[model samples]
Every structure is written in structure tokens, then in C-alpha cells.
Target: MKVKELEEHPTFAAVLPPATSEEYDTTGWRAFKPVVDKEKCTGCLICWVYCPEPAIIRTPDRKIEFDYKHCKGCGICEVECPVKAIKMVKEV
Candidate 1:
């Protein structure tokens, strides 16, 4: 069960679909959700830049929005926000 052995196995590779597909929804995997405080936000777009899923969105009005449908809630936005506007709250 070594990492290298599993990667080289045809059975393992064939069974697991590629995770790079645009339609692969990862919202179910989220343990926490990011919440943004609009008052505290300065429209810096830092969260949008640091997001791996690129789920943080910028509106036409220069406001920020979240795409919870595909957001994995990895907390990169919360960590990267210089204004501390985004917070990762418990999913419950």
C-alpha cells in the first residue's frame, strides 16, 4: 500500500476518475463554510486570488460573493484576507 505502488497500479488508476473535471462538485466535502463580513471587507479581492477552487467571486459592483456549490471550504480565503473579513465557520 505504498504511495508510489498505488500510483503505478492500473486498477487503482482506472477506478478513480480524474478530479480535474470542471463538473466535479466538491461542496459535499466541506467541513466548514466561509462567511464574509461585508462591513469589514474592503473589496481587496484577496480571497478571490488565494482560493484554490476559485469559488470566491467578484461582482460587477466590485463586491465579493461565494460559490458555495463548488466551494470545498479549505479556508485559504480566511487565512489570506488581509482585512480578516472572511471567516470559516462550522458547517453545522
Candidate 2:
């Protein structure tokens, strides 16, 4: 049978349940939050730009902030920071 014909079969529907919250739940998702020491922050935007998820935001004054909602804690920002201002801490 053609791929499209197979996809329409009732048997396929029986085997495949509707998508549910359990299928996409991220209860186990772990992320690292980066803490910036204001004393060490040089106002460089490197961390903001290097974050793969754009989790870091830089203010007009060059102070950096992190949006943990989308941050995966990849540590790229910590590695990219010129000074040791950014430190990765496990999210609670």
C-alpha cells in the first residue's frame, strides 16, 4: 500500500493514541542557571550573544540578565565570558 493510504487506515489510528501531556511533559528537564557576579561583570555582551538559546539579555547600560524560562544551561555563556563573571549553578 502507498504511504498515504497506510496512514489513513483505522488500524494505524488504533495503535497511535492522541498526543497527550505525558508525551511532551518536561518534568525531568534539568537546566543550569548562570549567575553573574556584578563585581566581576565587565558589561561585555559576549555571554548574551553566545547563548545558543538567546537566554541572556543585555540592558542598554550593558548589564546582563538571563531568562531561565528557555535556558537549557548549556554553559556556552560561561565559557564565552572573557572574565569569570558567569558561573553555572544547578537550577532548583
Candidate 3:
């Protein structure tokens, strides 16, 4: 099945649900989890800005927290952190 053919099929399109909902939990898809080191963190908020899922948020105390359940573990946080505070570890 070619990609073009699949898109043209009405049966496939009708069977699939709408893509507007945000309630789905995709936590199971992550192969690794990001762990943030509070001591090393400088409150730069770079991780929060680069996060594709926007799972990282600033707390009332200005500390960064992750919404682990919704986080896809894409490592954008780890890569964007200037202080190297966020580390991606195997989900075991």
C-alpha cells in the first residue's frame, strides 16, 4: 500500500476518529525518561522553551517540573539545557 493510496481510501478515513482531542495518554510510547537535577539547574527555563510537548512547566517556586505522564521523552529538554541539568535515562 502506497502512502497516496492509503490517503485516498474513504473507508480508512471514516474508521479513524477525529484528531482534535487532547485527553489521550501517550506515556507508554516513551523509551526513556528525563530526570532533572535541581542542584545543577539554573532556572534558565531553556528546557521548558525547547520541549516539543510543552511538558515542562515552572512551579510556584520557579523550579521546573515535568508532566511525565504526557512527556514523550524526546530529549529536547536535555539538549536545550545550558547547565546540563536534565538527563535522559532508560525507562526501566
Displacement of residue 71 (Cα, Å) in model 2 is 0.7
TM-score of model 2 vs. true structure: 0.64
Off by over 4 Å in 3: 1-22
lDDT rank order:
1, 3, 2
Q: In terms of TM-score, which candidate is stronger, 1 or 2?
A: 1
C-alpha lDDT of candidate 3 relative to the true structure: 0.85
Candidate 1 lDDT, 1-92, residue by residue in tens: 89999778676334655665657777889999999998899999878888887788898878799998889989888889998998899987
Every model's TM-score: 0.72, 0.64, 0.73
Candidate 3 or 2, higher TM-score:
3
* lDDT string, candidate 2, 13-82, tens digits: 3456664533453323546678889889999898877777666788787798877656677788888899
- In model 1, the runs with Cα more than 4 Å from the true position are 1-22
Predicted structure with the largest lDDT when compared to the true one: 1
Per-residue lDDT of candidate 3, residues 1-92 (tens digit): 99999878676434555654347787998999999999998888878888888788798877899888689989888888999999999998
